[model samples]
Target: MTDTIRQRAEAALAEVEQVSAVVLAEPTDANAIVPLKDADKPVGAEITKRMAEIDMSDTQSIVSFGSNAQAELQEISQSMLQGVRNKDVGPAGDSLRGIVSTIRGFSVSELDVRRKRSWWETLLGKAAPFAQFTARFETVQNQIDKITEDLLSHEHTLLKDIKSLDILYDKTLNFYDELALYIAAGEEKLSILDETDIPAAEAEVEKAPEGDQVMKAQELRDLRAARDDLERRVHDLKLTRQVTMQSLPSIRLVQENDKSLVTKINSTLVNTVPLWETQLAQAVTIQRSAEAASAVRDANDLTNELLTANAKNLRESNKVIREEMERGVFDIEAVKQANADLIGTIEESLAIADEGKARRAAAEEELKKMEAELRDTLAAAKSRRDGVGDNAGTAVPGA
Candidate 1:
C-alpha cells in the first residue's frame, strides 16, 4: 500500500513538472498570428478612434524592454562635437565642416523625437502595476516564512517538555524502589527490638561483660538513621513524581498542539489549502485548497503570457509595416501620410484580433479546469485500484 502511494506521488510530481515545462516553453497557437478574435473587435475600434484623435506624429514609439538607445544617442552627440572640433583645427577641413554640420543636424532632429528614449523611461510609465506585483510576491513569501518559524518553535517546546517528563518518570521509579527497601529494613529492626530476651538465654553471652548489649543499642541507632534517610529520599521522590505526572496532561496537550501546527503549516504552504482549521483534521483540507489556488494561478499565468506575447507580435508587425513603407524608392510624403490610415487599419484589425483572443482564452481556461478535474479522477481511480489489489492479495488462498 505504501509503495502504491509512493508511485502515485511520483506520477503526480511528473505531471506537475510536465505542466511547468509546457509553461516555460511558451507554446502559442498559429491561430494567434491572425487575431480576429471576438475580444479584439471593440479594442480594435477603440484603437482606431484613438489613433484618429491623436496627431499621428505625436504618438509615442513602443520601445522594447532593456533597449540601448540612450547610449547610442550619447555616442552620436559626442561624434558630432568631435567633427566640429576637427573642422575648426584646419582650413583643409571644409569637408569636415560639412560633415560636422550634417552630423549635428541629424543628432538634433533625432533628439527632438522623444520616442527614441531609454527603455527604462517606458517601464517607468507602468510602475504602479509592477510595484503591486512585487508587494504581493513579498507578502506571500513572508507568510510562508512566518508559518515555518511557528512550526519549528512549537516542535522544539514539545520535545523539551517530553524529555523533562521522561527524566521525572525515571526518578519516580528509583524512589519507589528505595521506599520499599527502607520499609523492609525498618520492619526487621522493629522486630529485633520488640523480641524479649530470656534471662537464661542471655546468661551465657553475659559472660562477655555486657558488650553485646551496647553493640545492640548502637546497631538500633544506625538502622533508625539509615531508615530515616531512605524514607526522606522516598518522600522527595514521590513529590517530584507527582509534579511530573501533573505536567503530563499539559505536556501531552503541547505535543498535540505542535503536531497540529506542523500539519497546518505543511498544508497552508501549499496553494490549495484553507486558511482556517481547528488544529486537528484541518490540514488536509488546507492542503487541497492551496493546491487548487496554485492550479488557478498557473492557468492565469499561462494565459497572461500568451496574451502578452501576442501583443508583442502585433507591435512588431506594426513596425514592419512602417519600415516597408519607408523604402527610399517611394514618394516620402505619400508614404509618410499613409501612416495615419495604416494606424486606423491596424487598430481595427487589432480589435478583430482581440475578440478571437478572448474566445480562445475562454476555451483555454475551460480546458485547464477540465484538466484539474481529470487529475482528481485519475487519483481516485488509482486509489481504488490499489485498495482492490490489497484486498485480493490478503484473501486466504482456496479458502
Candidate 2:
C-alpha cells in the first residue's frame, strides 16, 4: 500500500513537472480584439451564448433605470413651482411697508407711494430695507429653480451612462468568453498528451540531443517564456472586467440622489406659494390706501412720486429674479457636461478590453496549429524509420 501510494505521488510529481503554466501577456498596443475564428469551439460557443443572454438583460436594466430617472425629474420640476407663489413674501412685503411708514414719521399723508426712484435713490432712501429683503427672496427662489434644472440635466446624463454601461457589459462578456476558451484549449491539449507519448514527442521537439544539449535547453526556455506571457494576459482581462463593474454603480448612486432632490424641491414649492400670495395682497392694499390718503391731502405730486418709486422697486425686483433663473440654466448645462464625460470614459474602456481579447484568441490559435504540425511531423518521422529498418533486414540476409 505504501509503495503504491509512493508510486502515485511520484507520478503526480512527474506530471506536474512536465506540464508548464503559461502566463499570457496582455497586448500593450490598443488594437487587440477577440477573433471569433481563433477560440476553442466549445469555449467559444458557450461564451457566445452567455454573452448574448447578458446583453439582453443589460439592455433591459439600462432602459428601466433611465426611464424612471426622467420621470422623477419631471415630477421634481412641478413640485418646485408648487408653493413658490406664497411662502413668506406677504409677511416680507408687510415688513417693508412698516419700514416705509416709519420713515415718513408715521404719517400716511406725507409719504408718497408712487415716486419714480432710481436704484441708487432707493438705496439712499428709507425703502432700502424693503428692497434688500425682496432682492434676497428673489435670489433664494432663483437658487432653488436653478438646482432643480441641474438635477434634471443630470438625469439625462445618467440615462446616457446607463446605455454606456450596457455596451461595456456586452464587450466585457465577449472578452471573458474568449479568454475562457483560450485557457480551456491550453489545458485540454495538455490533458490529451499521454505519458508514453512524451518520449516520442521530445524526440521531435525541434531540438538537438548530446552535442547540442544547449539548443534543447533553449527550446524549453522558450516554452516557459510563452507560458508566462499567457498568464499575464489572462490576469489583465479579469482586472478590466472588475473595474467596469465597479464604475457602473457610481452612476446609479448619482441618479438616486437626483430623484431625492427633485422630491424635496417639489414639496418646498407646494407649501411656500400661498404664503407669498397672501402677503402680496396685503402690500397692494396698503399701497392703495397710502396713495388715496396722500391725494386727499393735496399731495398729488408726492403721490405720483411715491407711485413712480414703487414702480422702480417692482422693476428692480423682477430683474434680480430673472438673473437668478438664468444662473440656474447654467448649472443645468454643467451637469449635462459631466455626465457626458463619464459615458465617454466607459466606452473607451470597453474598446480597450475588446482589443485585448482579439490578441489572446490569435495566440491561442497559433499554439493549436503548431501543436498539430508537430504531431504530424513526428508521425512521418516514425514511419520513415520503420521503412528503413524493414529494408535493412532484407539486405542483411546476404551477409
Candidate 3:
C-alpha cells in the first residue's frame, strides 16, 4: 500500500512538471500586424462655400502690377544716384534724369490707388494673404503630424501589451488544465490508499488466531499508523488543490481586461488616426488655395476647429494607453504571484508524500519485528506444556 501511494505521488509530480514545461515553452512575442480600417472622407460643403466667397480677381490683376512697380522703382532710384555722383549734365545724364522722373511718377500714382486701404487691412487680409494662410496651415499641419506620431507610438505599446496578456492567458489556462489532471490522479490514489488497500490490510491483521491476540494487536497498530500517514498525504493534496482553485479568478480577470484593451487599440488605429489624416489633408488644401478674404477667414476657422478636435482626441487616447499599460504591469505581477503560490503548494505536497512513505516503511519494519517475537513466545509455551504432560504420565500415582 505504501509503495502504491509513493507511485501515485510521483506520477502527480511528473504531471506538474509537464504542465510547467508547456507554459514555459509558449512564445512570448506577437508576430501579426494589426489591421487598420479606412477613415470617412471629409465633407466639402463648408470648404466650397468659403472658396466661392473669396474673389481672387482683383488680387490676380494686381499681382503682376505690384512686382513691376517695385522693380522699376528700385532701378530708377539707383540710376538717379549714379547720375548725381558723375556730375553729368549732358544728353546722357538728362536722358537718365527724365527716365527716373517718369518711373517715380508711375510708382506714386500706383501707390495712391493701392495704399487707399488701411494699413491693418493690407497687412492682415489683403497683402499676400496666401503666405499668412500657408504659415498658419503649416503650423497646424506640424501639430497634426506630431499627434499622428504619438498615436502610432501608443499603438505599438498597446500591441506589446496585448501580446503580454495573450501569453499570460495561455499560461494560466494551461496551468489550470494540468492542475486539474494532477488533482484527479491524486484523489484516485488517495482513495485506494485510504479506503481499499489500507482497510483490507487492517482486516487481515484482525483475523489472527485467539492465541495470537498480542501479535494481532501490534499488527493492527502498524496498519493504523500507515493509514493515518496516507490520510495526511490526501489532506495535503486537497489543500493544494483548493489554493489552486482560488487563484483561477484572478487569472481570468486579467484575460478579460486584455481583450478589452485590444479592442480600444483597434478603434484608435483603424478609425481615429485615419479620420485625423483626412481632416489634415483638407486643411492643407484650403491653406494652399488662392481664395478671397472671406474664404481665407473661413479656412482659418476650420483649421483651428480641426486642430482643437484632433488635439483633444490625441490627449484622451494617450491617457487611456497609459492607464492600460499600468494595468498590464499589475496583471503580470498578479500572474507571477499566483504561479509562485502554486509552485509552493506542489512542493509542500511532495514533501508530505515523501514523509508518508518513510512512515509506512517504519511501520512495516516494526510489524515484522513484533511478529517474530510473538512466534518465539508461542514456541516456548508449547514446549513447556508438552514437557509437563510427559513428566506427569511417567511418574504415575507415586509422584
TM-score leader: 2
> Candidate 3 — which pairs collide?
54-292
Residue lDDT tens for model 3, 119-220 = 877677664434544554455545544443443344344344444444554544444333333333334444555678667766766786778867767765
Candidate 3 stretches greater than 4 Å from native: 1-147, 160-167, 200-260, 280-399
TM-score of each: 0.26, 0.32, 0.29
lDDT of 3 at 261: 45
Local accuracy of candidate 1 as per-residue lDDT tens digits, 174-263: 333333333233233323333532232344344545768666555445444544443444354345435534544553454355344434
How large is the C-alpha RMSD of every model relative to the true structure?
51.6, 53.2, 58.4
Question: Distance (Å) between predicted and true CA of 22, model 2?
Answer: 42
For candidate 2, the per-residue lDDT at 170 reads: 42
Question: lDDT winner among the candidates?
Answer: 3
The true-versus-predicted C-alpha distance at residue 7 of model 3, in Å, is 59
The TM-score that candidate 2 achieves is 0.32
Error of 2 at 104 (Å): 28
RMSD in angstroms, candidate 2? 53.2
